[model samples]
Every structure is written in C-alpha cells, then in structure tokens.
Target: MLGDRFVYVAISTILAFSYYILPQKNEHYPTCPTVEIYRPLNYSENKDILDKIINDETFRNSSLYKMQQAIRINTTSFNDDLPLDVGNNLDKFQHFTKFHNFLKDEFKLVYENLQLNMVNHFGLVYIWEGSNTSMKPLLLMAHQDTSPINLKTLNQWIHEPLSGDYDGKYLYGRGSGDCKNLLIGHLEAIEELIKIGFKPRRTVILSYGFDEEISGFRNENPKFIENIYGPNSMYAIVDEGGVSLMNVGETKLAVVGTAEKGYLDLSISIEKQGGHSSIVDKRTAIGIMGQLIVEIDNNEMPTYFIDKNPTFYQYVCLAENSIDIDTKLKNDIFNSQIDQNANENVRNFINKDKYTAYAIKTSQAIDIINGGEKINALPEYVELMINSRVAVEENITIAYNKFVKDTTNIAERYNLGLNVQMAYSDEIIEVIPATEMGKLTIKPITMLEPSPITPIGDKHWEIFAGSIKHLYEELAYPDSKVVVTPGLGTGNTDTKHYWNLSDHIYRYRPGVLPSVNANSHGVNEYIEFDSHLQIIAFTFEYIQSVDALDD
Candidate 1:
C-alpha cells in the first residue's frame, strides 16, 4: 500500500511541475497587423504619376532642389546686419520677409491671423492646409532659425558650413541637422504626395517658428494655436524632440518623445563683509560659495524622486539586460557589499557614456562662478550659476527649496557665514495619459519617469515588433530577443508645447541611432545616407499600415 501511494504522489508532482514549466497557449496574445508587411506599391504601373511628381528630373531638381539650395544660405541669429535681438527688430523682419516671399511663390502659403510681437524680435506664421476637411488635421512643425555659431568657428569647416554642399549623400550646412533637414523633408514629402494625386484622408498642416533658437517664451505661439485650431481639435502634432537610432549595444530603438523636462536657470548669490586678502577671515563670500558648490557636486538628488512611469520604465527594463552585470548590480545595489562593489564596477559604465548615466541620475552642473575681481582683494559678493534638468515628478519650487535648505545646513556645519538665495526657476512639465482608437493608447510622458510596462499582448506592440522584424532581419539581436518598446529621451525638445494641448503625442523618428557620436547640438552632425533611404521606405510602410486600420 505504501509503495503504491508513493508512485501515485510522484506522478502527481510530475504532472503539476509539467503544467508550471510548459508555456501556456493563449489566443488573446496579439500578432502584428497584416498591413506592416511591406508590399511595394505598383510604382512600375504608376510610373507616369511617380515620374511627374517625384522623379521628373526638372521638377525634382527645381522646386525641392531650389528650396534645398535656399536652406544652404547662411542665416545665423547673430548676423550684425540681421540680428534677432529686440534692438534689431527691423533686421529680423527683413530676414523673415525674404523667406516669406520665397515660400509664398513656391508653395501655397496662407497667413495666420495672429502676429507675434517680441521685444525686439518678430515671428512669422505660414500654413499649408490639406484639401480634406472631414478628417482630423495633423501638424508638422520645424523651426526656421539657427543658433549663432562663432564667427571664428564658421571659417574652420572643411567646406564652408553655410555653403550647403551636396556631396550626393549629405547636404553639409549650418542648419542641416539642427533641423533644416526636417523642414525640407516635410516640404518634399508633401510636394511628392500632391504630385501623385494622393490626397491624404486627414488634413496636414505645417508650423514653422522663427524664434525657436532664442527660446519661444516671449512668443505668442499658444495664442496662435488658439486662433487656428479653436482649442482641442488637432489629432496629433510632430516636432523635433527625439530621433530613432541604434543604441550603444547596436540595438535599433525608436525614441518617440512624449514629454520633456522643464528648463531651469538658477543663480546662487552669497554676500559677506569684505576684508583684505592678506588678513584672511574665517568666513568669506568666496569661501561660502566654494563650499556650496562642493556640497552640490558631492550629493545627488534622491532616487525616490524618480517617477517610474510606464513609458520610461519599459525602456529601462529592456536596456537593463544589455548593460554589464556588474554595472547593473551597482546601480541597483542597496546592501553594503553591493554598494562597495558598485563604486568600482560602475566606473566603466560611467566612463562609457557620462550623459546617459547622468540621465538615469540627476545632474547639477555649475556653469559660471564669479567672485573676486582683482588679485589680493577679498570679494564682497560671490555668484554661482547652476543649470539643472529637474525630473518632471518633482516640482521646481521643491527642488529649489531643497537646494536652499541643504546649502544653509552645509554653511552652518562649516560655520561659513553665507546666505543662499535662488534667483529664477521654472516648473517641470508632467506627462498626461491620452486615449486613442480602442487598440492604441499614447501617453505624453517624459523620460524622467522609468519606462512603463505595457502588456506584451497589446496589438500596438505586436505590430511594431512585426514591422521591425519584417523590415530589418537583424532587429532581433543575439538570441532572437526583440526589444520593441518605448524608450526615455535624455535630451529636451519642443515636445512639451504639444503635450500641453493633447496627450496622444509620440516621439518617433525612423532612423538608426548613431554609433560614432552624439549628433544634436554637437559638431559634425550628419545622418547616414542609407538611413535616410530606409526612413523614406519606412514612412511609406507606416502610412500604409495606418490606411489599413479597421474598427
């Protein structure tokens, strides 16, 4: 009887373990949408239409070609004759008027009702409305202006930076990457679509801001939107925020910027009684300022402040696997042994990409510090300029208050007679959830939050994964593990402007990430030739997928 019972128990245990170990089959797990499969449009049959609009040697080399040429002309914000400063209002107007006239003659330019009146700078608004009125409208945005590059540096280019030299692959110029390419891309895409008699189901609108390089704080962009769209009618808006590229591990990831951290400019001032340099005092303004800087450098903003929002955390989890085990363990280390080991192991990871590591952690940078003017003189006042990329979850006021309190405590501890005061601050913007068609949901969230974990069974995930797999065979790296999830962007962009109006914002640029260097705002910013070709094809495929969407 005992032997029989033992055999039955063993059999039962094995059966239960098998059920646990084996994969459970479920029908609800969504598959990629059929539309994602790239089927070449009957271009050969529609050769006449394609040739007339996109391929016509003259039209191609004429309209978009001329516009591309115009983009090559140097238009810096700091030109002595055409400064964008408030005092140079007339010069600014003249520069914009020239572009306005050009756009009017070339494209159908409709003037917006509202005008932006900056202190000395002026802004222009031109719109190109689509023919379809029944469907919702989409806004494609790009800034027209470029930041001023040093005059000395301008002459240092291999070819003139503003010359717009098209070496077949790249159009080398000042605004080439900072965003003339995007502006020109929109125009070329639209012109091509129109020539093919392809009327979009939804209306497409273009918004080009002239004062973006100087920051749009003083501009009346929100008012202009109110006048045109009437409040909440836009379906989606695309601006320069994040781009798709290969990550450090050569993984092709698309960074669709949903939100951006607010920009904060802080000035710390310390005042003290002046004394002779030879007669050194225990407490001086310069000494106090030095102490405060050290305190900020040594300490980090608490990790609890990190918002583990879904969109951000999802990317983090995916990236976590690619990182070195020791680096990963250190970042996540909570115990004493792990913490000690982390300091050594994390150095390699930290050295690889300081900016990315800093994005995962809070950064406090001291840009400017001024105190004593003359040697052998005791400074009566000391000032420090701090720039912080505050996390969205934390309020600027709270962060500022914390800084002040911490500075005060440190001063007291060192017996430094210093008073720390905050000069300026702005609130970090928060991401809100947006609901779309029953199958799709986009949240206008920033990278400050950890990647959000959405159910892998969702149709959107499946479609994205399948599309990537179909287009790029090498997408599944190492062991067929497909990382088809949203990622957090460390850089800031104009994503917040649209996110404020609606939540269905997604930051997606279909291109491989850079492997050699960081491009944006950096020197030698260039996109790969094959990458652009791939993006154009991907755009066609994406549009087809959208058209095939069913209720």
Candidate 2:
C-alpha cells in the first residue's frame, strides 16, 4: 500500500512538471510597459473642417468607390497561367498604364520617366508637394502587382477573386489585403486631405512599383527615389512588412516592425565512388550528406539580444510573466539569457516548435535532397539544399563559412569527399532609433533607430497606442503595450530595398489580423470591414497628431 501511494505521488509530480514546461497560449501572457495615452480632439470639435473633409460625398464616394473598383481591376490582373511573368505580358503593361493614367487624371499627378537606363522599365511616381518647402517629403509606397494564383484553383475564391465584391463590409478579393487596400488607402487619404484644403507641411509622394511581387529587379525603385529625393533627400519612408496584433495575457498589443532578418540559401554536395547494390557502405556520400543536414538541424546559431531594439525584449519579458514557471525559464533564456552558455542550455531544454526556440536560434531546414538515382544502385553524387535564418548579430559570411567547415569536418570523419557552397546570401538590416522635435515644442518627437532592436519605445508608438485606444475603446485591452519589433519579421518583403535609402523606416499594417490561420498570401484572403474602417481612422488620427507638432 505504501508503495502504491509513492507511485501516485510521483506520477502527479511528473504531470505537474510537464505542465510547467509546456508553452502557454499568448492570451495568458503578461503585459509589458504601457504607452502614454491621449484623447484626440473630436472630429466634431473641428466640425466645419472635419465635416468638409469626411462628409464630402464626392471625396468619399469617389475615393472609396475607386478603391473598390481598383481592387476588382487589379485582382483580374494576376496571371493564372503557370510561370507568371509581368515583364513579358503587354496586357499587364497596359493595365499598369491605365492605372497610371487614372491616377494622373484624378490626382493631377505628372507622369515622368524615371530614366534609370534604356533597359530599365518606365515606372510612374506621384508627388503631392507640401506648402512647407524646407521639410523633406514623406513617401507612401505600395505595389500594383498580384502574385498569380493556380489556374485550376482560381475559381475557389469567396468572391470571383477578381470580382472585388464590397458586400457592404469586407472587400473580398486577391491583393485586397496584401496591398491593394494600401494603394487605395493612400489615394483616399490624399483625396480627403485635398477636400479639406489641408496641405502637408512636408511633401507626400506616392510611388507604386509594378514588379514588387518579383523583386523590383528592373531598378525602377532606385531610379525613382533618386529622381524625387535627389540622392539623399527623404526624411522617412514607410513600407509593408510587420504588422501584428498579439494577445498579451489580458491585453492585446500592436507590434510595429523596424528591422528584418537576412536570408541565406546554401547547398551541400557529397561525392563518392559508385557501388553495387549488394556492396552497401555506411559511410557513403548519401550518408555523409544526410548526416550534415541532421547536424545543421540539430545545431542552432548563437542567441544574442539587441538592447537597442526593445520590442523583442518586451515580448520575452511579457512571455516570462505570462507562462508557467518552466516556460518562464525558457523565455528568460531567450530574452535575457541569450549568452552562449545559457543558450546552449536552453537549446537542450526546449523543442523546435516553440517561438522562443525559433527566435533565439538559427533555424536550418533541409528543403531538398537528391541521392540515389535508383532503388538498386547508389549514385556517385548526393546533393542537399538548406535554408537558414542567421541571427541578427551573426554575419552571413561568418555563418556560411562556419557551416561549410562544420560540414567538411563531419564529412572527413566519415572519410567522404564533400563540397559546400553558398547559393545566395542576403544581409540583415539593423534598426537605429532617433529623436526629432515635433511642430509642437512640448510634444516630444521620437523616431526608431536606423537599426532598432525589438520593443523599443518611441513617440510614434504613443501616437499609435493613443489612436487605437481612442478609436476602439470597447475592443481595447487596457494593458496593451505598444512595442517596436525588429526581429519579428521572417525577413519577408523588399525591406532591404528601403533599408538602403533611409534610417526612419517603419513597417505596419493597421488591422486586427485573425489568429486562427489568417489567410495571408493564401487562398480566400480577406479583411473585415470594421477592421478596415478602424485602420483608416487610426491612420487619420496618426497623421493629424504628427502634423500638429510645432517644433
């Protein structure tokens, strides 16, 4: 009987330990530092002006109607056929030209040649020059291209995919969320501003690239930036990348991305003498290559923290408080204990599925492998392809060299001939925070570092928090924290393009992104109608607050 009691107690303890170690849902996460809140002046308070701006039927109907129309037009613009090429299709060029002409007619925008090179394609840029001649311009950018869908599955859309059905609430179609909305939002915002006779203190330029989906390879973007900003004239630029609404314990937080990780594509090959089916060798080239892949998957890059980028730290800190004791320990190792030794220890404790594990480590996945040509015979050569995300501080070259050396060492142990080479490597951009005085001297102006770390606090953060809270008080999770994240983005988008041009680059999309398998870059992509309205309100409030600055 005593023995049975002992076993029961032991089982209970083990269960408890497992529970403590498991990752908790983010809804139970703790809150980080709160941002300052401000009540925006009621639009009614500035009724005459606000009314003229908001209630302009021509402005509202025309802009929103045009947005809906553009959504329909652009959705059909996607090439459903395989091997989608925007460069080759003359029809695609015509679509862009029509869109360009429409903007020129509606906004009085001058169509000018970027004149990069004769080979470089011609792209359109719209400039809304501000009354204040001294201040550098702000660029509002979005792409016009849509990634082609599979022809067979294209008809599976909730709407015709290209139908652009308003349904009185949500805009259902492709490019609606990915970027078409952004394009419409900018145009509508400008139209509203124009209706109120409100001119920006700084010039606001709207630039659309036709081939952002396939990388702006034609050099249209660089040429456009140079032509407008005169080499180095941009005050700041905003692009699309990181915009997330995360549940932090009882609070819902908004994360704005400031930096992105770099990408590296690598290939490993092992060569050995061909052998007969009957003569099997354990240390064959295929075996060596498989071992190399396993080693990479097992070994993670060193974890480190960027004190300058506070968002990631804030996330870790919140995660620590929200999770159970064992999970908290895991969070601590990732956020604060990123030292070499601590990371090694954490690596042993946690599995690969957790966000903490991915955040602090360089993830390696075997994307492709080629070995034996047939079931009966071993091929002379085996090739392996791997994709790795290097940590921020780790140089791509250093990481690549380390990978090669490590593979070589493993191959030598097996007495196999191995060759490793980098297929392609991209540099990671770091965010650096800066401060600027607002037009209102009393109001502090803050900007993220050219290379900011995650979760850093800034003036724009306060504006975002305040604007969101003011507009969505009912849905407002009080303990919500505003954090600037640099590491959250999975190195997606052409951030590298803008990173080269300006220091004050922020990536955010104002919407309540659904948690359960939100369709982004996938089928049935859609955004809620209320979310769209809220985002627009937030944008208006943000612009107003920033423009009110006096200094």
Q: Residue 161 in candidate 1 has what lDDT?
A: 59
Backbone clashes for every candidate come to 19, 27
lDDT by residue (tens digit), candidate 1, 1-551: 99999999999999776543433223432221222333324434543533343334465445435545655655555423333344535654357566655654555422231122222244444344444555455556676667666666654566565665566555455666666555555655555555455545555555666656655433455456656676555555556645455443544444445445445556666555666788866656677678777888777664321224223333343334344333343233212122445333433344346644443444566788887877877887677777666554555555566566656565566544433333241332211121110011111111222222223334444444345443443321224433444444444545444444434444455445432242444444454333433333333343333333331
Model 1 TM-score is 0.68
- The superposed Cα distance between candidate 2 and the true structure at residue 38, in angstroms, equals 5.3
Q: What is the C-alpha lDDT of each candidate?
A: 0.48, 0.54
Total clashes in model 2, counting residue pairs 3 or more apart in sequence or in different chains: 27
Those runs of model 2 whose alpha carbons end farther than 4 Å from true positions after fitting are: 1-34, 38-68, 74-95, 98-122, 152-160, 165-170, 230-232, 271-288, 302-309, 316-357, 369-382, 420-487, 514-517
TM-score of each: 0.68, 0.69
lDDT of 2 by residue, 99-186 (tens): 6556556554223311112123435456666667677666657777766666677767767766767765566766777776676666
* C-alpha lDDT (0 to 100) for residue 147 of candidate 1: 68
Q: Which stretches of candidate 1 lie over 4 Å from their true place?
A: 1-71, 78-88, 101-134, 152-156, 166-168, 248-250, 282-284, 304-307, 310-352, 414-484, 513-518, 529-551
